[model samples]
Target chain A: MSATSPSRSEQVPLAESAPREARESAAPAWRRSPPRWHGVAEALIKTTALVAIVAIVLIFVFIAAETLPLFTSHEVRAEVTPSTMAWKQTWGEAAARWSWQPASEIPKYSIAPLIIGSLKITVVAVLVGAPLGILAAIFTSQVAPRWLREILKPTIELLAGIPSVVIGVFALLVMATWTHRLFGLEHRLNAVVAGCALSLTIIPLVFTLAEDALSSVPKSFADASLALGASKMHTVLHVMVPAALPGIAAGVVLGFGRALGETMIVVMASGNAALVSWSLGVSTRTITATIAQEMAEVVHGSPHYVVLFALGAVLLLFAFATNVLAMRIVESFRRKRGGS
Target chain B: MATIEPSQRSPGGEPRAAVLTAAPSPKLEVRGLDVFYRGEKGGETHALQDVTVDVFPREVLALIGPSGCGKSTFLRVLNRMNDTIPGARVAGKVLLEGEDILAKDYDVVTLRRRVGMVFQRPQPFPKSIFDNVAYGLRAHGLADKREITRRVEQALGRAALWDEVKDRLDAAALGLSGGQAQRLCIARALAVEPEVLLLDEPTSAPDPIATAKLEELIAELKADLTIVIVTHSMQQAARVSQRTAFFYMGRLIEVGATKQMFTRPRETRTEDYITGRFG
Candidate 1:
């Protein structure tokens, strides 16, 4: 009946055909309409991504604005200051306080002590960790057989997942106690203990990134170098390592940023007394530890709160600068890959 | 259209070659040489089977074969390059100047220095053109700045690239065109001044114009250095080499004057391959 109606004598007019086709398409659409709740995920996901990105930016802006008050040069006080606040008189007055100091009249935020402490700890950590990480990477990527590589790589990477607070507690109880016994006449919050604990944190990052870089060296370069009568060790040292240098350097910077930002490890293992000295046995403070130790107690609208945020600013700038430098190194290496 | 003609063979050449077998002075020799690469973790794939050949001083010997027929493998074995691959094995004797190369006491470094190889592709170091040529010299302990400069120039001249590169020695060698890059590789190899220069399809990556230049360089190099080249082109083999060895499935089926091999080959495979038959 349907075939005879439209086939032999006359074709359907556009008015009739259009509605028929629209109904046919809509028939299937209605079947899927019942699941609109599940389909809501598409718009929700996009909106969530937008919200998350905006939230992160806002947090960064808030941190920067709150911290700006600490720079007396930028402002007499932070723009969001309480109406009842008094002007800080002198840098000496701010710095001379035993407890948390306010931003000084001349901005004598003697971060010099904290800076020195941070550097001493970081230098020691890099000294112990960089070579260890690079050598482990070389062994895993170049010398160790596949079976050993498969076993060791995951085991080493698993160290990265271990919480810093747990590591800090171990460093505090075990490492600090052990040092107190081994070395006489020492404060427990020594930079060395914290540095060692932090080194453990960085080693996983360095080993993973360095090995990836080393392994990424083309096999052909190694072959050619070996064919030229160079030994495997020589090939790796002269060719592979040199070729993968930027990536390794990036790994080291990333590890440094991580160690610098590490709070719990430094707060617990490092003697939290904010004294400026080079002695490994004496207690010291890193920026992260200072902020963490005082963050909750500081009044929300007070200069104390803004100062901790300023400490965060210092850490953020340090990390951002390092990341930019590492990225530049990688860029230069890529440019060299126009490789004649 | 052409026929075999021994351009350099004297009447008593076979007698001389036979009598000189135990002599202390052949540039390079391989006796019953075979190289095998393990296909799997433990599986073996024969890359080259029993092979025997000699390279006389100041001679260019062409190694010709289809792809994967072990021509390059034979070249690598000449310098113990097969030893680099895991589970890759070699059996037989390679001798440089009557000194057994595979002998445990022999220094592979000295052998490689004296038997340099130019690979299929140009591999200039990431440094300047000057550094690329200076690499071997520096490795071999000729590290003085002045001596390195002089030697780099001499090697580049020998490679016929000095005139073009002399003014820009500080520029990276990677900027060179394919032909120039190949020549830079040759210069790098020659910086060590090996007695026998091994060219492993060195011109394959270059255009014809570069290839013609390379052919000229080869002709010039063989004047004082022995050369062993592997090529897929029958005409190139005939054009640049005095003698040729034909390899098939890892075996050297025929070794004779290049002219004679292409014209009246002893093996049917050689004839078929030269005449464009299935290799």
Candidate 2:
């Protein structure tokens, strides 16, 4: 049998190879190569990925290019220098240290009031929003039953889909009257009203992110805490909350960034007054509102337009920094807990 | 052999032929216990059947079984950890020194304080080592800082981890090695000084050396606390436990002195399981 089969293997390759070579030569050129759309598809996807980065870079360049005129042009510089934008200048009779009157005969371009107004409103928004968001997250993750959580989560997230203009309208039309009557405030639409309305946007963002953070904490942590005789309250507050703190901080930071640059709500409800005062009841104007209001009427290529672009640049940097800070908080927490 | 002598000092060392010998009143007496878990689609899983057993005072009772045989489920029942599950239902009586812990009006906080548990994997809080141990004590309302510090040290000492971590108690507990974190979890449970400590396959995740260390720690710990351990390895149960209970298909097949059960298992299922015939 071995002797008979010794040449059998030699005949099989010749038989198989003759038709294989024929089929190979007979096949179309396109069959031998990959599909045509494969390369095109990959290139399209690659370009799509770069779109976000390219758009961000282009926006930065545009803002930077427009702002550069403030520093370089003598005409723009005469109207407002960097020093004039930051420092107080005495105008004739009144010794005003920080005024933002850009339309006067001798213009005062101090940005201190804008900065202070931004900080005050952002602080109020965060103070009102962060606690409510964080507490709702805790209730959803720790205390709510499964069916209730299923309903509560989506309903809260839906709050984010509400347009900022609608919230501003609600604040301007409804809440302004209530706040005015309750607090006996001089202005119906003020920083506090704008801030409270702005919190409507912050709540959903913070709630979604913080809830994710808290729920992602391993079930074993809660199990261990409960097994150790901790009350349900103690387990949630002491173990689960602390475990998710970094993520919660990141959420709050991102919320702060959102509140900083939001324009529609602030512009509509804040009454667009540029006075810098400590009282929460007084009408205020934010940097975002200033750019939204003045960028249309201010002469193109004027110092006022250049200053608005500078504010845009500042906001871009701030948003970038907060994102980086949030990413670092999450990353460092992961690295520290990498042993587990 | 010298290390093995300590485990033999328990009642399992005696030649008591009967499974339930006349002993002191049980620390925990479970009767007609059944557990049901509701599935997402409205189905029911009978996790544990009508099973009854007794955990004597200061005895290391090891529960051995294959995967999903309700050994871990039974361990969780001791401290009512199953209450955390979404649709878990429990029936029958679990008496801790004569009072029924499963009663409708029973205070779970007090019940859990008397019965602590450690999980299969080490679950130290994402906090400093000192705070991890001090967490339970503080929850029980021990406000004095010195008392908390003293109890934390004692618990860590009992878990054989105080010396390794004394210098850096401020270091994050998550930064510890696998075995150290496991011991830290044990110390966290011990800080409350529960009368019963339930360990659910505590050595399954660690290496052999860490497993040996944990087994040794268990033998030393049984002197003061009543321990109920669930394990998959027959050798682990033989090494550390006084009495061994074999579970199969959610039923307690046999439970007896550790030496007798391994050498001469009475039931055919117990014999098949111990001899590795089939899971």
Candidate 3:
């Protein structure tokens, strides 16, 4: 460093004696002026974000507007009132009051069977998906070798890249026969098969979110645990898992919402039966499936069309609620961490 | 080396018969330890080069050095914590009571239990204060609730933290002040009843008052437990340790009694560093 200083000093006067114009021209032109595209890029990104938020709000407004006729229009109300949809109707003494035969002569519209079916399939999906995803995430983040994790993480996430329709077709054709042979189910396509297939879709979503959370836990925490003589398994299970609980919970809630609103998978594999039975082997139809199956064929302004929109409105509200709840949980957990 | 009388060393501390003998057998005998880390540039960075030190029983041995001088690395060598780093390589022997802890088949879990560590930053588990102290006990299969509670209180008391945190044992450990949290970490390590405790710049994160409190705790703790502390502060080494080791560029420059090393350091580099000539 010292040896170069004399040579550097010897050249300073010669370089500085050059004209100011020459020095100015020597530097690159782009370095002298700010690029014009930077501001435009920022504005584009901001507008895109704003447009996304506004579009979501607009969609909810449109769906809610469509459901408004159920309360206001007499023609739509004659077939399905909010009260009639929720409560038992007197179709006949023999006919089931809590049925959903929308195309029958009486066109019964009790949503109980659809609600029960949605709950049953969603519950099954969450039960199967949450643990599998969480455990897989734990393995990838905490236990798996680096090479194995490199292979496993992308492969598991590849499940998400597969179109839900393809998964539905697989369930409808291949899984239907497998379930019938393995469990001897009464229906070849039942709630269990559809729920299991639905779980396959959520596993990747939950695993990605959960693995990110687990990986983000500070290394210091693990160091402290291990330095206390705790085994690797004990350190991960006790310390890392609890630290990442909020994120894991958010993943599970998002998976639940996805299962609730999923259309193609449930529609193709659930046998389209609106049964209120608690049996997993029986066929069922979720509200999402109901809307998807009926929306195209129904008359645009008919009671059935409005009823389907109302179910859509309900599904939309649930998705919104689940998102808000997950956000709240994550926010509260972050605040707690920051405060402590 | 000057041999101070045992009575003058620590008035009411643990017996120095094991430490003050003519040729004292080291509680931790590290011989020619070398650590190499694989750098991002695909080169082997020699972190510690042919370093050897002896930590006698019931003594506070302070390792003082500048940043990246291998003091912290030497401390981690006691418990084999360097094994966690992916590209870290260790050579030479770290013998604990004549048994080579660097052996291929050495059980790191057992080694860590016998030689506990407190990090530079206080990292309490995301658990209640009581649970933080009880983590090791439970990990090692001490299942009785009353026994855990009793041991937790005892360990906290040893760390000089029980009186402050006793009433709110259920409160999150992270809620404590930096000093209290560090003491809580000490308590957590103490709960395991390790013979040697390794502190790697433990006072660097806390405030001056906290540093003083920790220094005082070290004085009290050395009554029974052997301590190896790595610190950047020369004054802290002079105050808290019985013997001080000065390290520079991953080499042990000097090791002697704190009084002698600080007042009349034999090595020019050690004297220059202590006098703030260069880090």
Candidate 4:
């Protein structure tokens, strides 16, 4: 290189010229030039994103301000009144009990059963959805033929656009009867039914994401494995699968979040019996279902309405946590790749 | 070489395996090998045609030609990597260890294992150095964990990388210097223990020093493994290979011992190519 080129110091100065160019480009904005409409348009293209974020923050501030009064004024509880049925007035009241019911002019709030029911359905949904969806992704990415994969992928993703109410209807009419007949389930709107219906929604989400992850795996790794005399399946199982773990985890978490927030399917199919039972065949209710069912009946400014908002807060926190965890997993994977 | 999966029936819907042998009957034998692509224009475009060559064991054969000469395409035929290409077809025969690789009765998985390939770029797995070396072993289930660890050490040592990376086995492979990454790739191939290693311009992506180091490593590897190196750089072929074959317009112009082919040419095209004339 020295024989055919200038001295290394000359090259160093040439490199230094780059930083000088950067400085030249960094002059103060006002002195550079007055902006035109197109320039403003271009800047708007970038700032549109910033504006959207500010909009979101404004909405969040509004929600927080409106919701703050309830938390500050009173511990959430049912107000005893001259009535015939029991009902919980606030989420804080509901949260403090193991079971909730509004009966015969008396309103009592207990949300433990609803919380437990939500946990049951989400757990069941995740357990069934994650593995099946990931496995679908693995087969599509690693094993399926190119033409078949192209056709199958979009068809699977089409599930995402299906109306949630249709899925619920399908679950309620067809699947519920099948479950009751096959397994002799006592409750048609059981956790099992909700989980299966939710799994349908979850599959497409996880598959698209997980397939992308698996597809991004370097071909060299596959070649190296195959050259090692490993069977194609073996290669997929041992190398490709593990390498795509972060992506698979991301897909699963995203799927879980969608399932947790799902309302129509759970509302219609889940028995809405706040009774918490570990058996999948038994009746259950998710937080989403509880909110959906009670939202209409609760007075607009009542503590019960505020309690529902609190539930919304809880659900949002869960979804946010899942997304953050997935981001961390992906970030760690990228960092490891970078360090290597 | 690592042992091939014991021949077993694939559950319906998968292509059957092709038998691969690495006893070095002709390190590679080709007769009337042709590749064609069905273009969107609905016409067939031949990539390689009527190609024929016999590579001897323990010898380095270089394929040099103009761009799109199908030199790399023919090189990939050694392991049937072309099989992955859609609408790409290989007619005629490629014989390894006196067996017909194109025959439907053959096992492709087993065949690929016998004929390993290194791509033009050094693409290491997104894994730690130790895991990268261990990947082949684990994927094939060729050995237990204890044994795999041993082979990882041995393969890295053979690639001359153990010293630099011994203390940092857990370092990601992507972090390695260019030379190290290429060697790591070579180590991965070595871990697989293929009898034949097909390299498609192994050092093309590296610096001069790294390229030289790779040349040295190839010299060492050729002592034990049959190497078919495809290089566009004539200097590289002159320095590293035992035999040289020039390819032009998807055809093999000549094949002879490297020194004789370079110094004493039989084909005019080969002579022109080596002397820096039109391909």
Candidate 5:
């Protein structure tokens, strides 16, 4: 220590005595004048971000514009008024029943079955996925050792990168046949298979966000609890979980939104039959799948075309509402935790 | 409860019969304690070496040392808190009421119930003040709701915070001032009725007036509980503790009456440290 100090002291003055130009040239790049392209790069990045925001707004406006024709189109009003359409969809004659035969002799466009189908699949996905994701997060954050945590966290995140089309194919080919054989169901591809497959996609999203929330809780809280003689499980359940509840709720809501808007998996695995049935063994068709299936075949400016655009508008509104609700929950929790 | 009678031999395995007059009963006994932090790269750092100290019942024993001198580590060893660290290894015997606390089969939960610790920074649960104090009781399942309420009130009163918080028991603990929050933490620890209290720089974050109030509370608490406090303040050690232990570079330098250690330290190192010659 004594020998090194003298050498360090001697070198300080030697460096200070060097020429100013030599010192400036020898300095690191960051210490020198920034290159001319840095400003151009910053402006370019900012402009790209603004353009992305404007593009999303324009898309929403276009969807809203296309959907407005459905409420005002004369052919739609002549076929059935909006209120009568709702009534006929809810309670109508046996022949004019709740179905989605848009190209029949008398086009039937009741959306109740489509809404119920979306709800059924979304509810099933959230119920099965939320608990598994939350528990996996808890295990990774609180219970697992350091080495195991390092391995488990990335493996679960990798589940998110698997393409939805691949999952859809897997469910359509393997899960459909196996579930049918196991339960002796009437339909080979049904809502249960699609919902289960949708849950697979939801799990990775929920797990990543929930794990982030659980891990961000201050370590001091755990220390205080353990110092007070609380066991590990008690501390985790009562203290940590409550502190992180809002983030977990946000993750679940996001997962719900994802399941509601999912197209490929539900379209492939949920035999596209627009029937208003609650049984899991039967086939169903969600609004997203309906739009995806029928939009290409309908003529432009027709009632069917406007209605598909209206469904698109509904999907947009639902996504927006769920995101807003999740943000509100997260903000309220932050305020509460801040103790103001 | 009977106290473990203090022995004639000092904690460092030395005979202190010539200088010591009367020995009080020891509330906690540590013998030849060594701590090592094993790194992932197979390197090891020795934190504490051959640290042994006896804490007498109903007395404040203040440990004074420079930073990184193992004073905090010594306090944590009393309650077996070092066990929580992943690579920490402790080798020695820590006896609380004549039972080895470091034994593998020993129940750490019960030992922690008997020995409570207060951290340097005040850490209150993000809950109602009443719930914060009632947490330990509820966790241990030692009381019903009515009993928990009674104990919570009693602990608050003992901590000298009942008058300020009696009407606001349901308020969030995080809303309290720094001093009040720290006092609430004290009440939370006191609710469990531990026999020994270990305070790690309890006044480091509070104002001078709050520090004085906490010092007074410590004085009042010594009538019922044994306290082992680790503080960096020489004046604080001189003011609160009956006995003072000086440590340097992970070794115990001197242990004697507070007045004597401050005035006529037997070792040059202790004298230099107290006299502010060097850390």
Candidate 6:
């Protein structure tokens, strides 16, 4: 009993003293609170982020304020009503069609041609760009070797950094001529040319987002599929692609939004004809191009100014709706993944 | 201490008395295997070194070791799953019934089909239970719709998960309990009808009851497939395996009958390890 007692006594003090020594050592070095500068830095960062968000909201509010006149005033209403109703009276039965001649003897401001033109270009851009971007993302994430991925991904993303005006210039000068010769279209600068140029901008956005989504898939999922004897291609096509569907959809929606709101590329290459035609080969005018081309020349507080602001409001709403739709899609995907 | 010689039983000899006394053959064999991983900074780490062992047909062989002892690497080598890792080099021979699986131009897909693996964590595809079980069959194009349904049901039954999940076969596999998900993975593997199954710490993430269920499943599976299990639990190795191999620092320290290895190990290292003297 004495031998065991001695061992226990020795162990008890050692165990007790260990923590005492640790406490003693920890006491002097420890600060009661964080440093004063750290608090200052944290507050600074928080305020900076908040300021940026507030700035964006303020800008949106200002734009909304400017566009509110269209709805509140009877002057804009009277101007819009008569011009819309007197389309045939102004340009005769044959030529007085859905047009955007805002500077004529009687300014005709039918927005149908502008909406259709924007839709035509956006549809073409999405049809050509979405598949290309998604496929490129798949190739870079799943198929390309490491070195090739490093080179190709950065190079493709660099396309996003080039100014939109530069892309517009290139499309207006080089691509339009090449496409005109290749397809033998009548109008060299047309909706097809503008849409193709716009797709160049959209491809990078779609590719970057889709690639992130594809690579975010856990490696274990791929391992399980491969362990089941599925080929690499089969795994990519079935498992990875299906898992990334929501993300790809989000990227496409964002790209569509970008296409809809693009100004410089369409202004430079769309020919700004305001033609109500479905043919991609015909010249067109989008809402963004109309605003960019006509907003400066029109008198302030006039009907044309109100109409352009109204177009601005519509474009803003469309962009907001697109973003909301994309977010909802992504959130639903997350919920499905989480619940299942 | 008497040095125990490695057994040299022929294909037509009994390998274990607890199982059938029919002619036992080596289902899988590793001879002088070495695995090296090349580090990014131009150094090589020898992960597995000069390991040699045999897995007898229709019996359970447990590989017990501490962390990073190359047990998982050895298991992966059996099915060529290590090929997926970059800069992982393997040398020496791995034979599946006297045929060299490490031979150049060997079809890895077929090898993997013959030797299915269950990971440490249950990884059921984000699909229904029936679809998860049927994934392998569909991938290999092995069965029609009717046959697939039949095989999926049979595999689930074999995994002992049929009764609990038969009512919700179309329910998402991700919604299953941990134990149920592991069993579902087993069902998925068994759906391919592989001749060998490699389980790498299949019970590590499961609770004790789930672990016991999995141990029981291993016992039942031994009647149909050759099973190699890597585990961290000594009692699990003793309870589940007919043969047990101990590995330390990338080397096979000892291999013998499980009862004999635990009770009367020949090597001092093995004795010290079993007695909790040192790892």
Query: What would the C-alpha RMSD of candidate 2 be, to one decimal place?
Result: 7.5
lDDT of 4 by residue, A105-140 (tens): 444545556677777888888898888888888888
DockQ of 6: 0.51
Candidate ranking (lDDT, best to worst): 3, 2, 5, 6, 1, 4
For candidate 3, what is the DockQ-based docking class?
A: acceptable
Each candidate: RMSD: 9.2, 7.5, 7.2, 8.4, 6.1, 5.9
1 or 3, which is superior by lDDT? 3
Give all TM-scores, in the order shown.
0.82, 0.90, 0.89, 0.84, 0.89, 0.89
Query: What does DockQ give for each predicted structure?
Result: 0.23, 0.51, 0.47, 0.40, 0.51, 0.51
Worst 10 residues of 5 chain A by lDDT: A84-93
Q: Against the true structure, whose lDDT is highest?
A: 3
lDDT of each: 0.78, 0.87, 0.88, 0.77, 0.85, 0.85
> Global lDDT for candidate 2?
0.87
- For residues B138-201, could you state the per-residue lDDT of candidate 6 as single tens digits? 9998668999999999999999999999999987788899999999999999999999999999
Q: Report the Cα lDDT for residue A211, model 5.
A: 95
Best of the two (1, 4) by TM-score: 4
Which residue pairs collide, candidate 6?
A: none
Error of 5 at B242 (Å): 1.1
Cα lDDT of model 6 overall? 0.85
Instruction: Kindly report which residue pairs in candidate 3 clash with one another.
Output: none
Per-residue lDDT of model 2, residues A1-340, tens digit only: 9995856666566667777776466544675577889999999999998998999889888899999998899999988888888888777887666888887788778887888888889999999999999999999999998899999999999999999999999999988988998997868889899999999999999999999999999998888888888899999999899889888988899899999999999999998888868788898999999999989899999888898898788777778987898899878876665444
- Superposed model 3: Cα runs more than 4 Å off: A1-45, A93-95, A327-340, B1-23
Which candidate would rank higher by DockQ, 2 or 6? 2
Q: Positional deviation of A41 in candidate 4, in angstroms?
A: 2.8
Candidate 3 residue-wise lDDT, B138-240, digit = tens: 9998999999999999999999998999899988788999899999999999999999999999988739988988999999999989999999898899999
DockQ of candidate model 3:
0.47
Q: Residue pairs in steric clash, candidate 5? A: none
Chain A of model 4, TM-score against the native?
0.80
TM-score for model 4?
0.84
**Superior candidate under DockQ, 1 versus 5:** 5
